[model samples]
Target: MATTTNSTVVANTSAPTQYPFLGLPYDIFHELCLYLAPKELLVLYRTNKTLYNLLKSADGKTGVDGKHLWKRVWQNSPDSAFPPCPPWMTEPQFVALCYDDYCQRCLRPNLLGAGQIWTARVRYCPECIKTQFTPRNPLEDFPKGPYLNEFINEPHLCVPITPLRVALGDRELVRDHFHTPDVARLCRAIIDASAGAGGATDLNEKRSSVMQQWRSQMTQCHEHAKLCHIWQKQRARRIRKQRLLAKRYRRENILSRVNALGYKQDVSCLGHRYQALQGPILAVFDKIDALTDDVIAPQVIAFFDERRTLREWYWHRLIIGVRLGYLTKALDEYRQAAPDELLPHPVDIATDPMLRPLFTLPMSANVPYPIFQGLLPEWIQTWRKRRDDLLLSMLTDDAPSLWSCMDSKSHKSHSSRSVTRSSASHPEGPAAIFQHFYCTSCENLISSAAATTHTCCYTFVENWRAEAWHAPKTDGKFPTTTSDILDSACAREFQGITGWSSSCLRPCAAVISDILITLGLNTKFNWSDVGKIEGMHLRCASCCADKTLLVMGWRRAVVHAFQEHQGVHLCWVSVPPAVSYKAQLVEHARHKLTKEETAKRTSWKCHHCRLPRAMDAYTKSRMDIHMRFTHCIFHPQQGRDYYAAPEGVQFLHPTILIAATELRSENLDAVFPEGEMFRNEKRVGFLSRVYVTNMS
Candidate 1:
């Protein structure tokens, strides 16, 4: 009987020992735990009491190495993308708050974005803040109204009918929800302690100091919450703006394609007919059209229209209901489907049971599908590849012309180097008129003569001019200088230039008057009194949008304009500015060539041939030889007719001719004069030599 009992006991002990994981050495077990993610660890903790106890800290507060583990997990997660935990918050507290979305007070889900109040370390919904948070009277609460104001301003303090702990000199008193005898004891303790310290005089100062510190802490909490709210609002606004811009671009692209396709037969054609599709349905059409290579075929459009997908009410809700990602994925599925099989149409895809966010009436199974689904995707891919190749070819083929422009021996390039030394030596003479001008950003002085030749630093004045020429005469006679513009009597006679839009033509008189007080110009010259004076036409260093009409007279006027008069003092244009239209064209060409060259260096390909061939040799000389033999055969065609011949031959992109024309015009000297030696210039002298006789 004793031997049978011993065998049964041994079997039971052996059964418990079957778990190998639990029997692992302590070091090995810890190493294994380290590999598991926070979520996996949480799962393991819930699975068994052994794992829970192993993870628990000796202090009985947090899991072992909880801070480091939770922090590492959060850092690697997408949730840590923005709004990082404030430095004042602990890792555990932040993780807890992030996961705890429900209101603690009511235990119901917070419908609004109810946030946590970190100061008191609690969460509350908006409803609970007003209903559950019982406001304590200030006079009765903290011996005065200090605690009341703190509580009122604190956005986080939502707990109502809660116990309060107050410091009363050396004694600590806890006041209950019902305001029991503890409150009275707190008041007596404070009074007694204050009297013992040094009488009422010292007591008032000590109380005031403690109240001040508490107020400061509460103020910090309020500011933190306010800043966070503002950041969230701004982020949301930026996302909304980007989406709107993308939608507008898509709509404009569709309209452009519709016009290009020549579908408009007459007044009642596609162009006029599409005008009826306004509002949300118009947006859907835009998105659909943008996805395809061109305007969808008339047959495909008819197929969609028959099913009421083109109808206003149906498409409107579908567009608003479906996400962009789901629509793209559905389109991809259609593209990959068998050519013989009839794939579900885009409208049907949108309303799929699994994909649908909102319940809707089922689309008819007999709905006509687009015949071109399999063919259209392949065509679209081909068209895109051809378009990109053409763009790249245009950049590559025009490399020599672009380089020639940069290497030109024009007077603009030589003028700066030639005149720099002369200007410095004769600072007070005629040569001094070309004195060096320094950039505020780069701090490099570009001589007036060199300004035309200089490569744009992008930080200096965007539109650099050789010299500030006199403002052009509008009606054959008008005062030309800043001094003339600001004159009280002369200002009245100044009307804007004719034939130009008001946006382009500045009312110079009004602008100067507004800026004159802030100018702090020369102590010697009475600029307002000077008549029929000549001033240089200079550009602003930071001005963008040519519509602003930024023509200024010396450095001082430019400085004043930058400081005052709706001045953001920023050059925000995407394209860098140049000295002249010619310079800008040259720079644009150079930039395009550089971009293409960089791409070619990575993967050399011969795009000139009928079948685009990647060169095996990958030599510049080989590329040149291939281009001369192959691409030179094609004749240049005007406009975008070049885009039509996708495979047969290459046509030059229109931008090439546009750039050449600008450079040619500058060379002719008829467009922009090479020097300031015009009939007006023979009379106009240096700034120091200004006189009435010189104006004639």
Candidate 2:
């Protein structure tokens, strides 16, 4: 059985194969080719070498049979007006020149409509056109030889010229230009044809014949090119109209289906604008596929659902922002009215038990200011007591002696104390001292009232959480969990903001005790009382050098001791009030003023530094030491190097004037004087100006 199967396979493989189409008679094939369009005929011709050889004419010229067949095909074409092939060219070559979508020089495919230069009988891309064509002037470019006169008499007949309309001022001027390779070929033909000629008469005859034939060919090509251009434009318009009709049909079908699905209002809400919906509904405008319920229904539902969700999220945020704004205003008013009362930090207040739910509520829910304002008093009392207890505990742990003294004094009877007795002579509890609390995070002394709103510990973490909550995730989706659960998870991630931490409270009490001992004052002495003592001005001996004078209040003195001289003792010394006052004035001079203050004071001028155009005006806050660094004038005297100008003098420095104007306009890019500490102040200023311009 295996031997019989092998024999059968061998016999089948050895048999000759047959194609039904190729087997047709030549007369039937030629008849069928007549019905095919020019483009389709070209496609059939390229199917294989057999078809290519069969379709081409003998002698590679326009044979009578082949020309008849091509002429019949063109006559029956949709564009029957297509011009006939010129006598010098074969029908196939002309067809390929008009129908092929490729550059003739580089052979790159897909040249489309703009690529073919029908008059030139060539298809070239923009890049190839640049290299192959040249703008010419017959008078300048004609060669200096015996044939120059003939060339000058009629240059258009010698070589084909493409007329280009160039805009010059108010009119259009037509210029003659020719293909570079074609011009070279024509000149070489003239030279070679004359080289072998017996006399000038014969050469002239040959040249005349060639030129006359080209002139006729150019005329025919120009007419043919015009027809091709019109046909291409008409075809483009027809295709565009068809596409538009298809798009409209698809869009209407999709909308009707969506409405049948009970989404009429949703579709109407999306509106007719292209970018209104910004969802799958936009696909209807461009998509060409047939509308089906299975394909478009789910897309319509999902798009509207997502849009509704985004709208709700936006409304919720707006409500939260507005309510928070109201709460902020109320808090500011309360703080100004009673500056001494301790209140919770703004961030802490935002996340309070009573107000947190407001952030997570639906858009329809009302969150009036009274809702937030009503809870402020309770929050203040609770937070104040909590902070007081924590500070007291820290004091008791760090300094038992000081705590006992303050405790005893508080418990003592007030009736027994005389009215004339000074309160500074007796010790008081930690609560009595104003601005005595310290923050280890900022390494600064703060008041008990200020401590309530001190944000050193929670500022960074709270800012991060706010940004994370407001922004979407990497994949552009909001959190899927419940708002309350998400809020709690975020809070837990940052360990929660529950007032001041132990690190701040404990270090605060210890630093205060250490500062009291260094100042030779009782640990229980109130900071307010210590500030009033005569000649109590203190400077850090460790930070102040020979010429450098550093003077500050007792609060800063305590901070300086804790931060700079943490483990070491005896870091500060008392200075005379007069010297301290001078040092304070100098220190104030070194500091930069706010833009508001700079705009208010304009009498300042710099005498030592001369700017161009007399633009020498400066603000009083700025001119005090502008000469010291700006112009390298050392030891600038108040009256010589810089001083307040007379009432009539106006500061006109461009930078200063612009800064003042922007400040008045509430623009934040007001330029200020460059500090001596930064080396690249000019670069910094340029970057700031660029940033402000971009933002605006």
Candidate 3:
């Protein structure tokens, strides 16, 4: 454990031990008991009947509101990993374990993440109850504790805290921890009860101040809660809208094929012709279609002769049946199998005179869209927007283009560097433009009259531009300057990039918008994992076929294809981690080249010259030179054609390209190292073309 103290037990003994609890709330006691490292909780329970009996109750509560005290203790208990428990622990041991709990997120733990110094106890679960330190644990990126093997030899146990017999006041503990008495803003309260100074004093005064501060913080939370609630509700509504669209597509697809059969030339198209017919007419068609030559239904054909009136009757009958819940089960099944929106719209049958009877079906008053009796205008708009964004993400490189545009000199990059003043004693006007621009993240001020784009600190560019610090020129047209978007909200037309939220552009922001837009269908995923598979830029999620999908690769074919087809968001299984696309391509190419090299080394025969030659030197150039100059065959014709005099040539696998790219990279590595080396297989093809010509 990373700590300054040296008094608490550092490791559990070889004998698997149990916990020893003195006092605890019933509800918390039960939870904490279970949270103990492992066997330690059982040991604690067996210590005495008073604590053991109290823990037996299932539905229990700590009578007083402890203000997250028990929760803290439970979290601090040894991590879920590590399989061993601790024995009875002192107050310092308890406090130490509590310090490591509650941290769930953050790529790596920094100085602030390990809160062990302020605590006195080291928390451990019953299982593997040595100091609850993780060594090389997956997902733990912090310098936690030295592994068991590296910590100390022979299963030793040392108290984790300083040598002390008493507790310390707040300030003294803080001083002991952070090496500063002013750990927090407050002073003159309790202190560390170590041998030097500090004891629990003026508790009442500190409590009052803390209470006031807590009240103020609670009030602030109350004020912001309303906005948070509104935003959350809006998000829910948006998600619901997307779901309805997906459902609509599913429903629509169900009856589409059934309806398409109306155009079927075969007289036996039952589903399409009878789809809109009401119950009686539907039954008549069903009976006519069902009966054999043995027993013909006379009424069926007679009614079909009076086409106009008969079709109207059929339509009305079918509509009435559907409206009266007769078809409810069928429609439900349709939803289950496919869905309405996926099928063609029911409106396709509305204009058909044969289907006119279906329009007569009465509407129910209770349904949400009872007024329209179907989808409304607003629903249509919502569906269209999602669908469009999906299509944009799939087909168009709009997402990637945004970043590309921002990167290009024509858009934003070169303009930032246009601040060329050229003189220090008396700089030009352009140099002054660089004065206000500084990176907010790193606090680095940019210098360069020609500098247009901010380097190393260009996040949230629009927000910076909208601020006052970016003062605009006096011209009415307005020169480059920052103006707070909030201040000039009414005057400026704004759109948030919101990369974290956008499905289409966010996933393929660079590749789709940059490479695909420039190259069309050629743009897609290109990855390799020969080495350092962990170092690749990946899309957090994607939008596909009326749903948003969370995946790993930026180029998700199904997602992009479906998003182009339908607009929506959905969840999906992520791509398997550690599979490197780039590495796969490189390895495959190398394997192919190695095979060709092996084959050439084994097989050497100049069949055209009717003589044996070294395959190693049988390159295109060497072979071609030897074929035409040294040994030429008799010709029948005299033109550019091979039969006109060219003796012969041999074919070779295009595997040599792999070697050329490998060679180019080693040379370029001096400047770019591994960065400029990121590439796809096409580079190999281009390099092979050059190598072929040069060697020939």
TM-score of each: 0.24, 0.51, 0.15
Query: Per-prediction count of colliding residue pairs?
Result: 4, 2, 104
In candidate 3 the C-alpha lDDT for residue 359 amounts to: 38
For residues 570-625, write the lDDT of model 3, one tens digit per residue: 22222222222333343344456546554433222244321011111243334455
Q: Give me the runs in candidate 2 sitting further than 4 Å from their true place.
A: 1-36, 47-91, 103-114, 124-181, 192-348, 362-446, 451-513, 524-534, 537-556, 562-696
lDDT of every model, 2 decimals:
0.35, 0.52, 0.30
Q: 665 in model 3: Cα distance from truth in Å?
A: 18
- What ordering of candidates by TM-score runs from best to worst? 2, 1, 3
Q: Is candidate 2 or candidate 3 better by lDDT?
A: 2
lDDT, candidate 2, 344-426, per-residue tens: 55445556565467555766877787866777777667656666776555545444333222222221322222123232232
The alpha-carbon lDDT assigned to residue 464 of candidate 2 equals: 36
Q: What is the lDDT of candidate 1?
A: 0.35
lDDT of 1 by residue, 390-505 (tens): 33343233232221211112222222221112211212222222133333432233333323222232112221221121121221111222321112111121111111011211
- Cα distance off (Å), candidate 3, residue 5: 87
Question: Could you tell me the lDDT of residue 279 within candidate 1?
Answer: 54
Q: Cα deviation of 666 in candidate 2 (Å)?
A: 53
Stretches of candidate 1 exceeding 4 Å from the true structure? 1-64, 80-91, 111-114, 118-120, 132-140, 145-213, 216-696
| Candidate 3 deviant stretches above 4 angstroms | 1-382, 385-510, 516-585, 589-696
